[model samples]
Target: MKDRGHVSTTQTLDLNDAGKIIDAGIAEAERIGNPSNIAGVDAGGCLLAFARMDDAWRGSVDIAISKAWTARAFDVETKALAKLAQPGADFYGIHASNDGKVMIFAGGVPIKEGETVIGAVGVSGGTGKQDQGVAEAAAQAFARG
Candidate 1:
C-alpha cells in the first residue's frame, strides 16, 4: 500500500476544556460582582458547555450563545466584527445577513492552538467591555490548561 505522507485531522474541544473555560469565566464574574451567561462552542459552532449565573440577564442567554457561534463560525472575535460591519466597511450589514444570529460586539473570543481555532468562548449580561473581560479570562485559562 502506498503510504500517504500525512492526514489532516481537526482538533476538538472536549467537555473538560469547556469546564475549565466556564470556571474561569465564573471566577471573573464573581470578582466583578456580576452574573453572566457563558458559552463554549466547538470549531463547528456547536455548543459544548454553557452556564448562566444566578440573576444573569434572562434576555442575554441567546445572545451569549450567538456570540460563541459567531466567533467559532467566523474564526474571528465577535467584537472585531462591529468595526468590520460598519457602514461602507467590507462586511457591512453582515450581522443582518446572518439571519440575525451574529452578535457584533465584545465578549466572543476564538480559542486557538497554533494556527487552528479549536473552539470559542462567549459571555453576556454585563457591559460589552465587562463581558469581553470575562470571556478573555475564560479563553486565557483554557489556553493555559
Candidate 2:
C-alpha cells in the first residue's frame, strides 16, 4: 500500500525550466554571433520550449527540434552518437531509424539527474562546434541553477 503522506510520481522537466535552458542557449548563440534555433524537450521527448533567433535559417527549425527529441529519446548526446554512427561502427545506419528523426551530430545535449536523463536541449543554424557550444552552455546554466 502507498503511504498516504507520501505522494510518488516520476520527475519530469517543466516549461519553466525549459525556458531557462532555451534562454541560456540563445545567449550563447548571440555571444558567438550566430543566429540559431534552440529547442528543449521533456524527459518523454516532448517539446517544452523553443526559440528561433532572428535571421536564423528556417530549415534549421525542424533540425533543432529533432536534435532535442533525439537526445531525450536515446539519453545520449547526439555528437557522441555521430561517432558511433560512423561507417562500420556499431550504430551505423542508426540515423536511418526513428523515421529519420535521429540526428547523429552535434548540438544535442541530454540533461541528467543522478544518472537519469530529465530532459534535453538542441541548437542549430551554425557550425557543428557553434551549435554544440550553445547547447553545452544551456545545459551548464541549468546545472548551475
1-145 per-residue lDDT for model 1 (tens digits): 7769696689978888999999999999999988999999987889999999999999899999999999988999988987898899988888886789899999999999889999999999999999999999999998897
Candidate 1, after superposition: displacement of residue 85 in Å? 0.9
**Candidate 1 regions with alpha-carbon error over 4 angstroms:** 1-7
| lDDT (Cα, 0-100) at 120 in candidate 2 | 95
lDDT of every predicted structure (CA atoms) = 0.92, 0.93
The candidate 2 region of ten consecutive residues with least summed lDDT is: 2-11
TM-score of each: 0.93, 0.93
Cα displacement (Å) at residue 26, model 1: 0.7
Which residue pairs collide in model 1, if any?
none
Off by over 4 Å in 2: 1-8
RMSD of each: 1.9, 2.2
